[model samples]
Target chain A: ADVAAAQAASARQDSLTKPPRALGRLEELAIFMAGWQGTPRPVIDRAQALVFAGNHGVCAQGVNPFPQEVTAQMVANFDAGGAAINQLCRASGADLSVIALDLDRPTADITEAPAMSADEVLDAIRRGAGAVDADAQVLVLGEMGIGNSTIAAALAHAVFGGAAADWVGRGTGVDDEGLTRKADVVARAVERHAGIRGAALLAALGGREQAAICGAVLQARALSIPVILDGFICTAATAPLFDADPRLLDHCLVGHASREPGHTRLLHEMGKAPILALDMALGEGSGAAVALGVLRAALECHNGMATFAEAGVAGG
Target chain B: ADVAAAQAASARQDSLTKPPRALGRLEELAIFMAGWQGTPRPVIDRAQALVFAGNHGVCAQGVNPFPQEVTAQMVANFDAGGAAINQLCRASGADLSVIALDLDRPTADITEAPAMSADEVLDAIRRGAGAVDADAQVLVLGEMGIGNSTIAAALAHAVFGGAAADWVGRGTGVDDEGLTRKADVVARAVERHAGIRGAALLAALGGREQAAICGAVLQARALSIPVILDGFICTAATAPLFDADPRLLDHCLVGHASREPGHTRLLHEMGKAPILALDMALGEGSGAAVALGVLRAALECHNGMATFAEAGVAGG
Candidate 1:
């Protein structure tokens, strides 16, 4: 009855009010709701970007200039409190946790994150859930890895079921030939995992970082915590997340639309709307971190604003 | 030397062999420059809500329940300047301006806005340009006129080129019969002005307030001032402004994607990107005015954020 009434009211509203003007007002209302709903309060514990660092075997194909060693080294840098992502996390009041998993070699005290096995992914999820404070939500996610995009694209294709070319993109600025090779490699991986589906797809082609992100996202929702989705590659890795559990979307917010074409398609497929669209393609959860500021402002407006009725003004 | 070096360095940046992080950091530099260029002192000039008040001749066809006299009375209320929009403006650090352009009755200093003749609109453009200070900008544009949406839809059809049903939406809760009449009225208006195009279509079917807005927008751009476009009706009315000049787009930051289907089409035609999407159908430029708060914040962030280099962080 309520839904029917609301629908009827909306139809009546269409009949009564002017559409353009009303729609403009509604957009403001949605922003208000998003900002209000996902507002972050200062808790005793800090938020963190759980960067699950990993490597793809496909990088051996010379898809990127960086060696697999850089992934582990960067993990060490993050653990040693160096690196741009760490600095951004520091600036945004987020704790930096570097988890090295799926690498041929690993770093110390950075948590021996297992490879993208189902059990390892599940353990990562449990760990992320445990790490987050009861009073605060976690913004756990992945970081840079050589050929991570290929792994992510393969995972997305297996779960989302589109052509690899449609899902795969030029990760880390590939040349035309490299892009074709990257797409082919991802397609082969997707084809290899045709039998295993859903969360298993995360296990197959997803980087350790991506598997950790999938775990974090699932766990965050179970704990009633909110998550901010970053760029294309990270989002691709987490594609199996929605296929495994649709409810995870309720606890997530898209931070920004990337300049990459795939990111927009992913956002549309997930039925998510981004908060900002300044053509962001950076993937350190940088856009999401910036959006956290806007989210804070939105909450302030909703919680603090005096509505028309409260302010003794005519609303209509 | 610093400026030259910066430009020269920027020219050579693409060729630089750097990590992926370098590209991510440079875009912010462009944003910072753009924001800093917009304002030097970054003082918040209390904004003004200028509501153009007028009436459409089509209202005489029994297209609305409210008598055309209401337009003049609303103008008087605005002249006394105690309308809801006026009150909200005053409360939100916004001054209110009531330009009684097409009121049935003459108003004293309600600002003699003649019938939306081309000369009048051009003069209005000059007047709108004159309203802003050298350092400050007006952040809102609104209107209040009886049966104005008829003019709005006709303008949308003329500019956007679609069926009347596609563009002509319910203006003010008209019933099925009323909607038919409203569509018929708009279709006739569109047919009547087949030869007329752009601003001329607006002048023929548009209300006095709309012409003033068209003028205001043009002037705003000439003076490098920005205007917050309101919802469906206001957008429909302003459609011709874009057709008249494309440079005007730089000055228009769409506040919301209005619910009216026509509004979305109009926004697309104008090449203005909306900042919010709430399905709001309210007018009076309230949505646009509210969105300015966020735009201001974006400007602040762009201009004021400390870069990695400045913050003594590693760029790569």
Candidate 2:
């Protein structure tokens, strides 16, 4: 009751803009900013996606039909500039940076693939986030691990302390029976890491890419940068990060509502509003890249709008 | 059970895209285009707002301190392109068209305000909607009016056949006592027009602009051009139209879930989603105009976009 009263009072207090009631819309937006780290108005000096490319161990399950090699192939596709997420990011003015976080048994072709321990992944993320100029903000905390959803689900279960069977879902649209098997696999993974919490959960169940994203989200929040959270996989991994420190939610903006039912439920749990509901299940932060334009437009509208009082019109 | 089954089947039938499971992110956009007049993938070549500008008869109750003149001034503000809605529409590439429907008394000095009766409003709406190209769409809606909430409550009571007290709210932040007075006035208005259905309710209490908007929404639906709905005033008029003919739901897209509490329950009654939860209370079709951009992006993404198969990428 005390918290509710405080929130209500805050909601009313934030409505006080310069010249009283003028710029009501912008005033409301400023109130929304109170929940984030950025100065009430976030200027996107730079929008970047750190694609944590990796092949997951859970692909051994029949949960996903795609071959594990596609993870590296897609990484090469991103590097060669052919992936759809790459194209969309380019179109939307996002710089794509790839980190070869993990491929437990590396194939012969890509020998340069960086083998990162959980701590190394964290260090790399902090380093990448540090590379951004102080004035500019990193907008996307994105992941690109093949079969990472299983890893994400397990990590999320441990982080938020949810049941593995309840939190686990049909990643890449497995059948009802396949879903049961996937749940069992995730439950075993979660049980194996039951005592672990926070960053440890990432090391146990989190993919290299997922751990890197956790680092980026944490670093971005520390720097007051806005992190655009993509669909289920990204949210699943980051849920624990937020649970570890609720302040992390301050720097995040929900990119889009994923078609996966768990995604919207998780977003609601986190008190986020997905700017778009475009049913984007294709990962690699495709939805986040697209959502940037909408947020940009929203900010533009919030800033550029001529208030009713400014227009010398009487209020209704 | 029967209605749920039918809706489920309708939902399934709406998912038939050209290439099965190819354009994953883009396929969900089909729901927005499912009931358009043109081909399934309708081009939103031009979008227009049919703003129903009027003043409620019940404003005489002193619920709002602003004289009814603000309605006409705001309408002129919209015409002279000074209102927030105007700025937003200009930002979003929408044509602003205004109609002066059934204002009880216009403030002097506003030039050439069209005084439309219920009949004229219906005719103008049909004609205005028809003027747009077949591929284009229109959102028929209302903006500000003194004591508009009272009028809406009366209209809702008449159409949804609920008690007027159920729908009345704090229009423009009336005090608790003022709200009681406002509700009483609407209840009286509802009694005066008791059992009056559809057009007669408009003739009795609905403001000119709201009547025009209602007419436009129904005509647009009949003509098969999609109509995106806004807040309470527009929605109150909608009940009568949908009550008159249930088929109008086909062409409708609810833009924002209004800040007015009545709207959520109404939307649920109509079974709508993809609601842009903007918490918007200001009308003038601003919310719908913003939603139009979202819908346009969805349509464009749907119609344009190489399928995973087309792009020769392995499905994730």
Candidate 3:
């Protein structure tokens, strides 16, 4: 982070027409953006949102309510601009891209073996990293996969060392029976991959979309582009990076708290607070896209509001 | 609210490609707007934001840090499109207006006597009701007054039967001494007018802005326009109406939870959850304006997203 720029932005906020820190978290957000953009006044003229969709092999366990084919079908819906993410991106002024990662070739079901080989994880990461637009001022990362919530639960349990039930939640809406099966799948997957650690744990229990989110986060950080992470699945996807290095998420914000029970716990484990808490659980960057509007409002106020001196207003 | 339209909107949400309730509060918000707009798909093409500015004679108690003149100065800043509210409204695509209420004449010092005569309060209410634009799909109500926080605290204490200290806060940056003085002033004012009740409490303890907010809220409800209320001062201004009849606020949504310690308690007392909680305390309708973006996103997703049949996607 650019300390000098952050300091400058904080100083500017105090000089704005409003009371000192009256804008609360908005002042902190503007300063955070200033540090990332390396400018006292930062603006997001170009925002990019990426949705990575992949089919989860864990569907063989009957953990998810939706069929595996739904992943590819949702991707087609995204392409047709008929998905929630499409409408959200249009409303938030974000340019969106949908990337389907080996939908026809699902990873090995984690209940039986590692979800992906090390090479496969690396390949997905590369694909995610390559999708970043260097010119974009901000990035929003989300995912779409049939059984990824179970994948996310297994990954969270592996990294955070908690009860499987604590990390499992109904992804897209599941019945009581499906919920029980999902918890069982998560428990079995985490116990099987208990020995794996760090980023390799992703290979053991995570899917392509998860690895891609990690890659995209890394790429955005490399290019000094701040990222807004989506819901539980998205947060669990990048947990490996956070576990490896706490500073890895310094340029990111959790977009919203999801209705999925594990999402709040995962966010707490990561010591992150989401920008919005509308209980949204859709994982197509929808929450992140909505939060983009708040970020834009923060920047607009930061860059457009006249200083006390400029407005000839008295400061308290 | 049109129950039929709300039901229709809720039904439409279920048919959307995403999981049931995946959009969470956004779905509820869309349904609420649909009920208010009397349509299954609501759009906010003509949102109106009204900021009522007034001068408080309660400043005689040294309850505020800024001079009363700053209220008028900020109004001019707003007119010049240089304040936070102006920038936020521009970013959120809301039409903005500033109504300065007899700024040349400050209200009576509430510690000594009623803040405004009953006639004066009614006149202010009339002005407020007159300010509402009939064509507006949604109304955002905010206020600007130098000592309004103290006024809000007193009004809340008078209406909600709370301890004066519980309703007092350091509005717009006040030192420990000022906070103590503000609390003392609230106690004295509430004690002085112990018999006041319902809408009459506003005249005894509130300023013109508060009365105007009450009027605007009533007018919006009469016109079937949903209202998004600003922070503590604005909320406290309308507390009298809520105290009179809980149903009076059915058309209203608290835009954001304010940093003022009393605001959250006030929201709890009224059983209203703010749409956003960015810790914002600047009350020029700034928080409500920011929430307008969220509301717009909800409506856009509701109106624009393709249904399961349209997208040819499978439902769980």
Who wins the TM-score comparison? 3
Rank candidates by DockQ, best first.
Answer: 3, 2, 1
lDDT tens readout by residue for model 2, B199-316: 6555566565555566576567666667777777677767767666666666777766767667776777667663466566667776676666666655554544443444445652
Winner on lDDT (1 vs 2) = 2
Which is the better candidate, 2 or 3, if ranked by lDDT?
3
CA lDDT of each candidate?
0.58, 0.60, 0.92
In candidate 2, the residue pairs with backbone N, CA or C atoms under 3 Å apart (3 or more residues apart, or in different chains) clash, namely B52-B209, B101-B208, B102-B208
Tell me the TM-score of each prediction against the true structure: 0.69, 0.80, 0.99
Give DockQ for candidates 1 onward, in order.
0.17, 0.23, 0.88
TM-score of 2: 0.80
Among the numbered candidates, top DockQ falls to 3
Error of 2 at B59 (Å): 0.6
Off by over 4 Å in 3: none
User: What are the per-residue Cα lDDT tens digits for candidate 1 across A1-316?
Assistant: 1234334333332332222234433323223333322432212143556666667666665666566666665555556554445544544456656666657742111112212556766665565455554445447354667667667666667777778788766666677898888777767666666677667765566566776677777666665556677777777767777887766666677766767667778888888887666555656565665455444433333233333333333323
Sort every candidate by TM-score, greatest first: 3, 2, 1
